[model samples]
Target: MKENRSREMYEEIKNITKTFQPRLGVIKDEKGNILTESKQIVDRWKRYCEKMYSSDSTADQQEKLEETREDKEINLLPLRSEIEWAIGSLKDGKSPGCDDI
Candidate 1:
């Protein structure tokens, strides 16, 4: 269920980003490492969500935000804690229904 929600949000963000086409300005992270994972996702989202395009600052920034929104692979904006708990349960073999990993 959570995976499905994550996929849905991902698709929605992808659609929005392609529609905006932000220039991505630049993407070096705090450690001076170009967040390659984020950069890759941003690039793909831009290509995927192109409802229309314009040479305006707002559009580009919106796209950039939407594209770069995902901080980590497992993070879905709406279900972070739920997913985290599930993972913790799995790690501890405490999930009530699952017999094995």
Candidate 2:
């Protein structure tokens, strides 16, 4: 019967998933030592994010942006009507993008 076949297929899929082991590559720290423990991995990632997104970088980035703006002549600004048309052209009810709309 169709019900029996569906049940067999579900059981086969369950067994396959139960045996599945994702192959994760090795992660290391700044000292070039392999990190195996979950806590160590989490801590390493935390440290990396903290270093990458430190508060002092914001002011430095703003200064660099101002310098770049002063050095470059920007003439590719889109008109407000063009931007509205672009937004209106997009279909609704779709999945949100990376910035979540």
Candidate 3:
């Protein structure tokens, strides 16, 4: 019947996530120390994700697009009568925006 009630609700949510044991409660460090074991909270989340994606310098610190100026004027091509007035203001079977078209 609905695939055996979705395979008995996926084996009762995989045996309630195999007896579930997730608490990760204490974790502090960055000199403030606390942690609490499970291998020092997995080596403090692998040294805070390797110091948040380690990058001392692979150059390009940014800034040049002719040094940057345009506080306003930014047309970048839309006008075909503004894409036919946004497909004539959408409404038949709606949903399209967020590039979901």
Candidate 4:
């Protein structure tokens, strides 16, 4: 259990230490499961920085960029129903039951 916790911590720290240009894609876990792949999230950060530093970029361009980014994000992948259902159940204070289907 300690080893597992240590590995998880290391993974989290490794993620925190990276500095890179934002690319649109999913980040995966050790088991190749996606942790986050929200293009909207990445777009928001870029837009914020641009708004602060790149004063020449107009609002119309930003709005168009947002629309393109959103379309990419929506089409990149879809979540499994089981995962969504379980998340909803936990959020609603209900138990997630196992499905044999």
Cα lDDT of all candidates, in order? 0.64, 0.85, 0.73, 0.68
RMSD of each: 21.7, 9.9, 12.7, 18.1
Candidate with more favorable, higher lDDT: 1 or 4: 4
* Candidate 4: residue pairs that collide: none
List, residue by residue over 1-101, the lDDT tens digit for candidate 4: 46559888888888999788786465554455555648755655576676766646676678889999887755555469877886666755545687677
lDDT of 1 by residue, 1-101 (tens): 46559888988888888765566545654345564576665765574354235456568888888888664566537678888887776755354675664
For each candidate in turn, the TM-score is 0.18, 0.45, 0.25, 0.20
Which candidate's lDDT is highest? 2
TM-score of 4: 0.20
Candidate 2 accuracy as TM-score: 0.45
Query: lDDT rank, highest first?
Result: 2, 3, 4, 1
Cα deviation of 47, candidate 4, in Å: 18
- lDDT of model number 3: 0.73
Q: Candidate 3 lDDT, tens digit per residue, 1-101?
A: 46559888888889988866898678988888898878888888898887666663222223334345444457778879999999999889867567643
Point out the higher-scoring one by lDDT: 2 or 4: 2
lDDT score of residue 1 within candidate 2: 44
Runs with alpha carbons beyond 4 Å of true place in candidate 1: 1-55, 74-101
Query: Candidate 4: misplaced stretches above 4 Å?
Result: 1-55, 60-64, 73-77, 81-101
Order of quality (TM-score): 2, 3, 4, 1
- In candidate 4, clashing pairs total 0
